[model samples]
Target chain A: MAAVNFDKVVKSFGAFTAVHGLDLAIDEGEFVSLLGPSGCGKTTTLRMLAGLEFPTSGEISIGDRVVNDLAPGERDIAMVFQSYALYPHMTVAQNIAYPLKKRGVPKSERGAMVQKTAELLQLTELLSRKPRQLSGGQQQRVALGRALVRDPKVFLLDEPLSNLDAKLRGYMRVELVELHRRLGRTMVYVTHDQLEAMTMSDRIAVMEGGRLQQFAPPTEVYRAPANRFVAGFIGTPAMNLIDGEIRQSGGTWQFHAPGLTLDCPPLLDSARPGPACLGIRPEGVVFGSGPIEGVVQVVEQTGHENIVVARIGADMRLTGRVGAERVWQAGETVRCGIDIDRAHIFAAGAAGERLNRPGLRPVEAPAVIKAAR
Target chain B: MIRRVAFNLFAWGIVLAVAFPLFWMLVTSVKPQFELFRRPPTFLPETWTLEHYIRLIQDTPFLTYFKNSIILSTATTLVVVAISTLGAYSLVRFKYRGRESLAFLVLFTYLLPSVVLIIPLYLMLVSMGLSNTIFSLVIAYTTFALPYALWLLRSFMAGIPEDLESAALVDGASRMGAFVDVILPQLLPGIISTALFTFILSWNEYLYALVLVNSDSARPLTTGVMNMLVSSFNIEWSLLMAASVMMSVPLIIVFAFLQSYLTRGFGAGGVKG
Candidate 1:
């Protein structure tokens, strides 16, 4: 097992930056995920850590040693690619045995190791069969088994489960977690799917536009995202942002959007109101019994759950999650409430920069200069 | 239907045009000596004879020429195939400064026509005392064959995903190990077709063979036939045709056996998407 560290690493293809000044520390035996949307540099960062791609600047280290110049094999890291690029000419047994054979392991030891891995992956019966003969899931297991047999310092997976169907992806996600737990190896997985990141990772590093947005435990990231982008990316319905003045209405603070307003969370009142964006998660947008009102625009039914998309005003929409039993319909004006304790106030001048509660502010956000008096 | 029938007739006319010389040669080989001068050609001989084939084999150094052709062509094919495949793989897989330029240079070797380079090559060979040797012919054949082989195999290798080898590399393979295990096996059919082409090319080549060779020792069958028919102006047309018949037989048989690789031949020009 190894601790992988990337120190201010930057990767560029010519002038176009692919991964920008990424610094991360993945601890031994930890399953961390690099999560983001496509083209967000998650794969490039994983490749750098795997030594398949070189950094344009800065350094990377695996365990105690600096592995910046190490070839992929020398770094002792194994990667399972999305395509499950098995050697087509080789049988399952040979494919799994490739690493050992390359290491010049003796024939008897190679046979033993391949047999053990194949059995662990439940590929014993398919040992002599070629990759084409195996089902997709079986080929995936072989690709994974090929990595496991190496007993590498770290396991790097570049969207390994993305190629599988949804149900199989879920199954393999659990299997992968179990495998990591059993072996206790450092594993860094990359995926654009937020659900995969939330379910599989010990820590999730969320990225956007080639830069790190937040790196924290998955729950923390989902609960207290560092910026607007992280806030919107980690959740299912995506957090709602209604842009308007944070005005004092009848001496009780309220979050305001055009043609609509809400009772503001008490925690936000200490700071003077200004042009701010009120952020609330769809789950926090309650179904009934508060001042906020909207004409129901659309109701999406997903079995036991309901997603209500409503139009509160011209050019503004709000989404609320309710039980499927609820009858919120289009053109019906529905009363709802915001869980004020969970509401967030971001400065418009800062443009979605978080108002980091109490006496402090984010270091990047300077002293308040433009708040409405 | 009318256009289809017209197309069929046109195609058959072209085929008959191409096969007419071979058909005439075959009939003349078996016809009696006097039948060759018939006012109108004898489509079928009144009396067939083995007399021309027997005389041709016994009177000429046919066996020596046959052996020379096989040795030079087979050796050239093996040498060219072996070297070009490795060279093509490196050019395709490895990225380095000047790689594209180097590939252009390999292609440029083909642009140097044999006729223009023959005098210098012959002078060099004579100085090295290799002018009439089979080894020299192998070297000459490589000059013509290497570029095509390299171009063909390089394109074939390029069609294979680099991700395949990267997967192997991460699976604990060295770069060379990945090439041998993952990429080379997929290239097998391409290499075989390349070898077959080079072999046929070297087997039929007569330009360099004629220029450098002064004796029967290094003469391949094509030159040996020409030398015999020309020197003996009162040539036995039947015997000459019989020799041509024998020379073409091996190639036909070889092609018959390896015809499945026409699909594999497509692997060379190539498996380009």
Candidate 2:
């Protein structure tokens, strides 16, 4: 296993730049994920690490050897594509044994190695079957087997589970984690699915517009997003970001939106409060009683929880998660509470960098606020 | 029920209309010489004769011409498929400057009629001392077959997901290795169809063969069969029909083996999900 380092790497395709000058370093044997939406350059970054793409500038090193000029084959990496990309014409054994065959391994050795890999992936019975005959999940296993049989220094998986059905995708995600633990190789996974990145990576590198927005553990990223983009992008039902102005109301800082006003989180008082964006996680939007009031516009029951989307004004909407037992109907007035300690405040500017409250450590925010100051 | 019957009848009508000429040729090839000039043509010959077939094999240099056609077609197919496969793969995979224009130029050559190119090609061949040689025909056939072959193979190669090759590259295969081990296997059906296409093209091509070759040893079946009308007074219709049937046999066999791929191959390579 090898550590990967990217130093100010930039990738451009003619007039369009896919990846800006980006610096990232992954520790040896760590599973890191480059997570972003489409066209956000996450795949481009992974491709550069694999040596499939040459960076326009800067350096990349794998275990202290600069690999900027190396061919993808020379980089000692294996990749699992989103499509599985199993060879349609080859049997599972041949597919798994391809890298060994290419490296001029003896036929007997290649056969034995392939058998071992197939058994590891529970594909021994499928050794003779072509990829088309296998189911989607089976094909995925074979793709993994092909990569595993090589035992490359790093494993690059580009949305490998995206093609599987939802249930199978979850099953494979856990399997992948087990596989990573068993092998203990450096793995750089690229995915647009936040949940996948959250559950899979040792460190999640959230990116936007070819720039790194945040690189931290998933819990840290979830708890304290770096900017408004991360705040909106990382959560399910997404974080509710309401645009408003912070004003002094009877000595307490209050956030005022179109039809709702509430005491601002203590964090806002430290900053030069003007126009700011308030980010509250769906789970942080407490129901029952609070200063802010809204009429429930929709309540979607998702078995474990009901996602309650309430309209505060003509255009402003806030979604909150409540237990499935709490019944809410459209047009019912409900008082909502914002968990101030859990909420994120971003400066109302183009960058929208997160603003921290005074006297609170960066990593530790209080669980509950007595009242918003 | 009536609509279905009408549809079936219409389809059968088109099939028969297409197959009738082939059926007529087969029957006409076996007809006796006495029935050749009958005022009203007979659907079935009164008596079948093998005299024309016998004459074609024994009297004429038919075997030599057949050998020449096979050699030329096989050589042309090999050369065209090789050049086009590489060209198509490069066009689809690489991001080099002028690639789009180069692809456009290849298809542009295909658009130019071979008839318009015949004079210049013949003169060039003559200057190179290749006139009246089978090599000249092979070159001419390759030139005409290359563009469409490249076009078809490019689309087919493009249909193959790029991620497959990327996976191979990251799996410790070189670009060329990935191509050979990964891309080439997937392109087999397309390659077979292209080979058949080029083979039939050169086999049936008459204009270039007629202009470039004069010897019986170099002449293909298409031009060789025309030699039967030596004089209008002695027009060997039965011999011509027999030779025509023999020439089509190879094509029919090829199509029969590859009919499914042939129909699908045309529509296969253009779109990818």
Candidate 3:
């Protein structure tokens, strides 16, 4: 119902800084995910917005009012913790009605609201049971029901589905997206799982070392990551990164490494060619026959697709995805074609900013190059 | 099978060894005065008599002593549990300097023996003009019970996740509301166990009761029963046994009522379950 904004928020515990100069603005009814690896300050950022943690400096606001000094109760936010922190003594109905009761809602109205919320969560049959009597998924639903029944201005979920089984996680992911659609409340979800952030978030904020790395849509993050960390962290088998130098070969500029060489994209024509990192997605490394030849080190079948890890030389290893029908074996000499137009190029050192290429728009094209005979 | 049998035998031996004193007290309370003085002690009385019980009720102020013990123990348990709960909550939830050392200091107090401090405590009470009063016994009992009560409840409070209370706070409840609505309920088993422990400690306490109170009207059952042996030249063994049995009945009932909670794992299903 309200936009949440963090303006240069920094959090530290004693001498250790957990979040550093964070600035983010979540629009009304937006489902934004704060995604990062563990200890990356994603949860700390969410807790600061929830008023559970006070920022060491800077301001956080929900709607137009700055909430830096407000208590969590005064912020009118509901949070579903990763542990599904349900009151063990209260039954499912009572758990759902707790927020309403705390707000001093009358008995009859609270009862009606509890019934409605439980029915929405498909927990009507389990209302009489305590949290201990319910299944893991049921306990999760009850936690969700408790947060939802209050109908707060913003919903904060900290890896809520991480406790469930794999199958249940998948089910809950869809259900959560659907719930967000129905409610259309500003929700800030914190998770380390990239798939969850990719599948559910309208915009994902990828973080590293207590700082925001990239904030963009899922496709933009996948097709055009802002930095090397986002490039490596956002994908499944992860993007293959090769450290090499760009040098003038014959007349055109070419990237050269241990056992690889490819024409540099025209985007680098203006810069003095030095050291750069080449990033290629698994799908971008087509594995039929092309310029790059390597021995397949390992092949893993994931039912839907095959992931082939190939070593091109003494030092470089690249993974490529192929159709399930194309059987690959270890030690097999396989040639792969790198999608040069779709590949990402970054500076060699720590702050690896992406180098923009003129011909490459953030659009999917089957620009498959054939092997040289 | 042989090892299992040996283990069972060893366990039953310990149980019998512990139960023998209570068994002897019950049987001796019902024995007639002549049987109590018999050379070969009777495990089972030849003739059970109600004369000792009748004498205890009619001759002595045994009822008044029993009533005073109940009031003192109940008051001590209530005060100890309330003070310890708040103290334990502050110790567990807040992050201040010396928090760990403060908890350590409370545990250190429990290590000090009551007999070591009884003389100074008695002198202080006399100077304060609090001697021979039931209120003095209550105050002494609470001081003895508080350290252990705080230590027990502090550990129990530590097992409860802070997330439960944080969730409550975000659900529109104030800090105190979260403590009362979320934490207090989960602490039920721990509180029950602490109350039972303090109650039993106060009830069976003889040292403090002996030093703090002397008047029959203010004396607890423990000291009052000891006074009986001194009042008569010939010790009435049957009457003493009857009084001992009566004093232990309330303790047995309280233990039986709260035994399950006392031994249960607090916060079992609060998090993952």
DockQ of each: 0.39, 0.53, 0.65
List model 1 lDDT by residue over B2-98, tens digit each: 9999999999999999999999899999998988899887798999988888888787788788888888888998999889989998898767889
Candidates 2 and 3, the one with greater lDDT: 3
Docking class of 1: acceptable
Per model, state how many residue pairs clash: 0, 0, 0
Best by TM-score: 3
Ranking by DockQ: 3, 2, 1
Predicted candidate 2 versus true structure: per-residue lDDT over A1-373, tens digit per residue: 3999999999999999999999999999999999998999999999999888899999999998999999888888888888887877788998999888877889989988998999999999999998877888898899899999978899999899887888898899899999999999999999998888888899999999999999999887888888889888887878899888777656677777787676666764357668988888888898889877889999988777788999876888889988888899998999988877677778886459787562353534323211111
Give TM-scores for every candidate, taking all chains together and pairing residue i with residue i: 0.84, 0.92, 0.94
- Using lDDT as the yardstick, the better of models 1 and 2 is 2
**How high is each candidate's interface RMSD, in Å?**
4.8, 3.5, 1.7
Query: Comparing 1 and 2 by DockQ, which wins?
Result: 2
Q: What iRMS does model 1 reach? A: 4.8
Best by DockQ: 3
Between 2 and 3, whose DockQ is larger? 3
In candidate 3, which residue pairs clash?
none
> Residue-wise lDDT of candidate 1 within A58-131, one digit each (tens)?
98999999999988888888999888888777889998998888888899899989999988999999999988
- In terms of lDDT, the best-performing candidate is 3
lDDT of 3 by residue, B146-255 (tens): 99999989988998898998989898899889989989888888899899999999999998898878898999999898897556477778898999999999998988
